[model samples]
Target: TVIEQYEFCRVHRKEEIIISYKIEKGYPLHIDFTILPNWIKSLKDELLKIIKGQQYSEYHVDAPGYYGTKGLAIILKTLTEMFVQSKILTTNLCIPQLLSQYLAQVLVPKTAIRLIAEDFNNIFLDMAKKIIID
Candidate 1:
């Protein structure tokens, strides 16, 4: 369902990162990086840790659980950090706009929302607070 609803495209060129999402029935959303932010550049080690720490198999399994949502929240949180550190306005962000479409569609079904919400609570709310407080 998530795959059906959203499509992701990523490209790494020389020193730039470009990530885009194509939502069904919605225009494409892009997160283009012409230059790396200092904060992101400094987090090379942390980024490696994040990538290395994931349980990749859980992402591939066809199950109704929090794994997918956890992954999504991680991306969202990372994007949030990027925007904040770059001093970019939230209005320019694209993931939230793309995600809003998916959320709207999921609301109609309501079956998967619980797991998503659980993961959101754990990864986005709780972890974010801890990171900020610390």
Candidate 2:
């Protein structure tokens, strides 16, 4: 089953969208990510409740030490290191927005994006193949 397919456009940073890709478009796509403590403590339980309600139902982080959300914990970790470097420090969403644009443009191009999409499609096809084989 194709779960969802969407295109991300960088209107402000228009140069970022090289190609649209499918993040995950099939069943058995494991979105179950790890959790972190820093995000939980900093963002708080209220935020977590909201996230869970939105179907981001995974938490693989220890509390009090990391204090970060599972999916975004890596970003948080990087941001903290940047803060230590005397860079701009704040709860600014602009950084993330720009980073998103970078991913759309620089990291994931049309070919790469298409590859990932095909991968998802292949997963579904393989599952069907397996059922037939069984």
Candidate 3:
């Protein structure tokens, strides 16, 4: 079947972000994204609020991390899976990113996406703990 016909690979890089999907006709659709530092900073700030208990949302979190809802642990595998006030602020938004409120032009796989989100969230949690929350 279709699922049996194709393979998947994950890619990460500094210049650009890419997500590829295989179509039924055996072709692949490619999506590319550029997330600037300011955008990343804005997202970090949003997560910072949550880490310091300045934010609250539904009780459930995405996966196997004690990160809980303490930060960007919002149980969303894709950026488009926005939970509530959750969003990534940026000046550049493609149509799909705009629709999903996700910074990426395409969907990220389950755990990988959440892991990246948590990694960013943890940055503020780990470094500027007292200045932000206190």
Best by TM-score: 3
Query: Higher-lDDT candidate among 2 and 3?
Result: 3
Q: What is candidate 2's CA lDDT for residue 80? A: 43
**What TM-score would candidate 3 get against the native?**
0.23
Where is model 1 more than 4 Å wrong at Cα? 1-67, 92-134
TM-score of each: 0.21, 0.19, 0.23
lDDT by residue for model 2 over 63-123, one digit each (tens)? 2111113433454443344332343333252244364443233222211222223334634
Residue 134, model 1: lDDT of: 25
Tens digits of per-residue lDDT, candidate 1, 1-134, equal 67644433222341133112223312213322222233233444433333333311112222222223443444334444543445442333324344343222321112222223332453443342232222
For every model in order, what is the number of clashing pairs? 0, 13, 1
Relative to the unseen true structure, what is the C-alpha lDDT of residue 109 in candidate 1, on a scale of 0 to 100? 16
lDDT of each: 0.32, 0.31, 0.32
Ordered list by TM-score, greatest first: 3, 1, 2
